[model samples]
Target: MFEPRLALASLSGEADAEWARAGADWAGAAVLGGVCLDRSTREAARAMVADRDRSEFLPDDPITFVDDQLAALSGVDLRPGINVRSTTAEPVREVAAVAADHDAFVEINAHCRQDELCAAGAGESLLREPERLEALVAAAATGADVSVKVRTELDGVDLVAVARRVEAAGADAMHVDAMDSEARVADVADATDLFLIANNGVRGRESVREYLEYGADAVSVGRPSDDPAVLDRVGDAVAEWFAEEQSPREVEP
Candidate 1:
């Protein structure tokens, strides 16, 4: 499968046309528009369980805003947010509709470390709730393409089991937050056939190659986005690696 050499970091409430255009021009790959859903707040969390209008809850509707932003950002498509904290079948359907309307993809967020999410059963906390995770995946899949971005659960949870469930749910891909360890990443890749995108503390080209060698289909670097110089360095490293991989091998005489 083809893997993205570079994917713009999730912008979160920054899904404006300018941000999208900047991301498209700079990254030249998929752009995950920051975050859309807000289940972090106490009131928002309560409203979700009660099935109320959480649309006006967040600073802005990233799903609705992304449609216009994506029009400006030609090369990159949208990856709308579905934070596990407040996500329900209803809002998820709306997010999916926005994605479809703009020809974008849906990304289920299970990696955020926000305290509110942990308190309200969202983000990494949801990883412990396999049944709920399954339901979330099934709901998110109602869009064009569904991809779940999650953190590695090394405690007692079985990564393989989760990966299988995700794949079985017909998710397009799985983004694993491999953190800083290569060994942990290898273990996650051993568990599933779905395309794996590695994240967490990846800073340079060498690190990117290390993850790929560990069986990652793609590597996501976040810190580089804030610094143009770092971004350029990473971009160059990726280009060099790809060029070398495509270079002709010398024939033995």
Candidate 2:
């Protein structure tokens, strides 16, 4: 439903305001957080953000801190679309509402694989239970567009089936963190017509086109985006792609 030809996938706590200012100008959309849904998970979120030595130093208001974290980052001048990732336990309408209030898209995180997240039944743990996941998506009460970020290769979980249920629940996009199952993009693409965001190991413009050719509506870059040059390559690729799309096709003489 969104036109972000290239999206910055949720980078957990690594997506600070400084990172936002530098990267926001290039990517089509910028995703902030993997910001946790509740208290226990918020601790987990902070731990994940801090280095091993400074893990216990967070002394701020959690609700305002987390919401404002993304809100402040959204202040970036050039990022066209802003999205926030949250890991929740039950009804997610509240989280979605926060996103709506912030004028941002809300994404359900089913991709983070931390031990604490799984133990708490958040993150990739949701992949093991499709009904619960679908319920969370269906319970969203806001007008903000919802995106479900999924790791398609989770053992025993049918990626296509999950995508179908997400679509049935009226989600706006499916962010597929294809991992090594990049080929499965076609399967997910076939299963739903929702805006598909292909993620993981996107190195260059050709890789972007590869996923698009495989049926993804957008390509998301994660680690490589830490480097500005990589971001430039991604932007150039998208520009060239649009150029090609708008150009007249050749006719055989």
Candidate 3:
């Protein structure tokens, strides 16, 4: 069995630095900065360029954040955000440019619940329009590694179909916001063979185990480090799990 990988869901470049200081092992792991599509948010993020403030703040611009994250976490791989709307093509190009420039992976954002994002034809709302979603993935995949982030819903839209369409559109991976259910994860895993990174409400080792069993290729965690001890414990748990799995089986006497 392959050892599971862990990624820190960084809200900004500063948050990425904090995760590194918190003893996160970044080798072969990813550091994903949140979506940075808004104007004001972009301005603030730009001001914080090279500024290492660990204080809480909003998400940073995907481009700028990815650049800094690549430098800060040199050994780790970078996956930047790319929250695009259903109709627009401008943001698609911008996100693709950033991904190419930084030599980083681009993740299409469809999991954010912000009202402005939804009203602007972005975020989870994009999941409702399969054709548009396919187009966005197609356009994004043209430049770099493109992954789509989607939330699992009970009714509204058909997520399985969406996953298949995204995979067919040449997306390198699928970031499934499972919210809190292994069944939803299994649904996504069953729908496509694309690399799946399970997110949302993943708090500890047990939750990670459940996601892995459901066929997740990786897991992302956020805010669990609010308690330093919890961060250490989680890291140890992950390392222990990998160590034990890597150990060879004992031979019979």
Candidate 4:
């Protein structure tokens, strides 16, 4: 029903059907699951079927995997966002089409720091390779809204430049995980017009409001969102804040 001023960032295997359903009404937008299209997810899925110990946090169905979750979200009028990992533009349009079909948002997984993902030239590896990220965002359908998730403070990476590049490459929004320096969110927002979701270490509504004040369009809770109560508190806080900001003011005659 809304564009998710209060949101839940992607949390691999933990973010799924039951979790999505539990926080359905609380999170204006919820990333259904993490879908990685790379050597890592491929290995994980294969290992999953072989009963081996692996990440076990990947999309098996890839294309239609989140359809059920998206359907459940649609039942509640919540917007669905799918966080995905890939090393190439080969599947960007296909994935974008799936998200567009459901009116959901396709978020590029440039935030993951897994070793295997980086080895495969996906995830944070994209931070070092801006050209590839540009190709992926460019491959997204023109009308499909795309979000690029990236980590800040990586060695040798110009985060501000990365944000500007993604925005220029057609990413409508950015999910910024300011691992150690939360100021990077505002820095990026101040430097560009990209709608930003301030992420990392967000504990409550106060942090949410802080990020919003710093220029984020929204704030996202990841690990803490596993508990439904957190979403409840943040949702309630956002409602109160929204009212205050929208309330009428007396004219200064």
Candidate 5:
């Protein structure tokens, strides 16, 4: 878990150590990648770029890239993390080992909704396959602290149930991208004690307050993570909220 309760969420190709370092003054934690950990997912990432002009972190050796990224953040104060996409547990296990070595956490990417990633049995497709997702979470937990980035409002998929399974699988956090259904944060918070990080459309105090009130342990800034003005606004709001939360309330006579 991170302090100040503010996080900089992963932005596929742009979220590298340099990106995280640039935002470090505002956020308490920085999650890097959506990095493809194996061949199938890497090919899918390539297809996404080639077919749709999407950017991806296509390192020649993902594990080594992970090592270097985390190592780059060793002198930084914020908690560093990696968001990974893989079809099997072995690669997850490998990357998690590197995360452990760097005192960083590993986040399983169950939130990416791209068609190519889903077709490769990674990303949002994992939400439809609970057992496999749980196994990947468990595999990651063996080496390092595990966080599962999940998407909400998917038809017929119970995100609350998924949160429970992730906790049972030894995950330490649940990063929820509550697309349009922000109330789902309360639902998942009600069901599990996993450290909940709420995401999507977070710009200022009102958006930050909504999620904190809904029981999110932290709030993350996605697309605007690099904007200092937005980060200053969100980061200050988070500090104010947590300060207010800890203040003693007086009873009325």
Candidate 6:
């Protein structure tokens, strides 16, 4: 579990060790990449970069990239995690071993909605195939702590039920991109004991407080993660809220 309870969510090509380290003072953990883990997904990720002109981490050797990135963060105090995309469970196990070696966590990418990734059976497409997603989670857990990054409000998909499945697969955390529905955080928290990290529209104390009030154990800042102003505000809010929760209350007799 993340102390300070604030995480920096992965942002495609931009989230690297340097980026995560920049926000280290505020965040307890940083989930890096949306790294393409296998041949099919890596090929798909390349197409995405070409077609969409988006920045993505497309390294020649992805597992080595993961190892290198985590190694770079060795001096940083925050917990390191890798967010990976793959069509099979084998690659997850491979990266999970590297993650375990670094004392890091493995986050399965079930939240991305990229068309190319979806076409390749990666990303949010996993939500529709609960069995595969569970298998991936179990594979990652075999080597290290596992977290499944999922999006909320997808049609015909029940997040609470998915949370249960993820937990059953030995996932230690659930990263929920609550989208437009923050209440889903409470719903998932009610249904499972997995540590919930609420994401989306998290800018300041108001947004952070809302998620915590809805039962989120932590909150992650996505796009603006590198902004010190945002990091400062969110970090302060988290510290203050947790402090109040731990402080002794006065009793009027």
lDDT by residue (tens digit), candidate 6, 1-253: 8888999999999999999999999999999998999998999888988998999999999999999999999989899999999999898999999999999999999989988889899899999998989999999999999999999979999888889998999999999999889999999999999999999999999999999999999999999998999999999999989999999998999
Flag the better candidate by TM-score, 2 or 6: 6
How high is each candidate's TM-score?
Answer: 0.79, 0.85, 0.73, 0.88, 0.98, 0.99
- Whole-model lDDT, candidate 1? 0.61
> Model 5: which residue pairs collide?
none
2 or 4, greater by TM-score: 4
Candidate 2 off by > 4 Å: 1-4, 43-62, 73-91
Off by over 4 Å in 1: 1-4, 14-17, 33-57, 60-63, 74-85, 248-253
- Model 1 reaches what TM-score against the true structure? 0.79
Report the number of backbone clashes for model 2: 0
Candidate 2's TM-score: 0.85
After superposing candidate 6, which stretches have Cα over 4 Å from the reference? none
lDDT of 5 by residue, 13-129 (tens): 999999999999999999999899989999999998999899899989999999999999998989999999999999999999999999899999999999989999999989999
Pairing residues by index, what is the TM-score of model 4? 0.88
Name the regions of candidate 4 deviating beyond 4 angstroms: 38-41, 44-55, 249-253
lDDT (tens digit, per residue) of candidate 3 on 1-253 = 1123665554433345445445344323444545455464344334444364423234334456555655565544333333333345555656677666756566776765655456666677778877877877887888877878788864678888888889999787877777665677788888788887777766667876677778887776666634555555555556666677689999999
Better lDDT candidate (4, 5):
5
Please report the TM-score between candidate 5 and the true structure: 0.98
Pairs that clash in candidate 1: 11-34, 12-34, 12-35
lDDT for each residue of candidate 1 in 1-253, tens digit (9 for 90 to 100)? 2233665556444434564445443354454544435444334444543574332224455456545555555544433322223445556656667766656666777676655456666666667776767777777777756777777744876777777887787677777777555666677678777777777766777777787778876666564565666667666766677777789999999
> What's the lDDT for residue 168 in model 2?
91
Residue pairs of candidate 4 with colliding backbone atoms: none
Give the poorly placed runs of model 3, Cα more than 4 Å off: 1-4, 10-23, 26-31, 38-72, 75-87, 225-228, 239-253
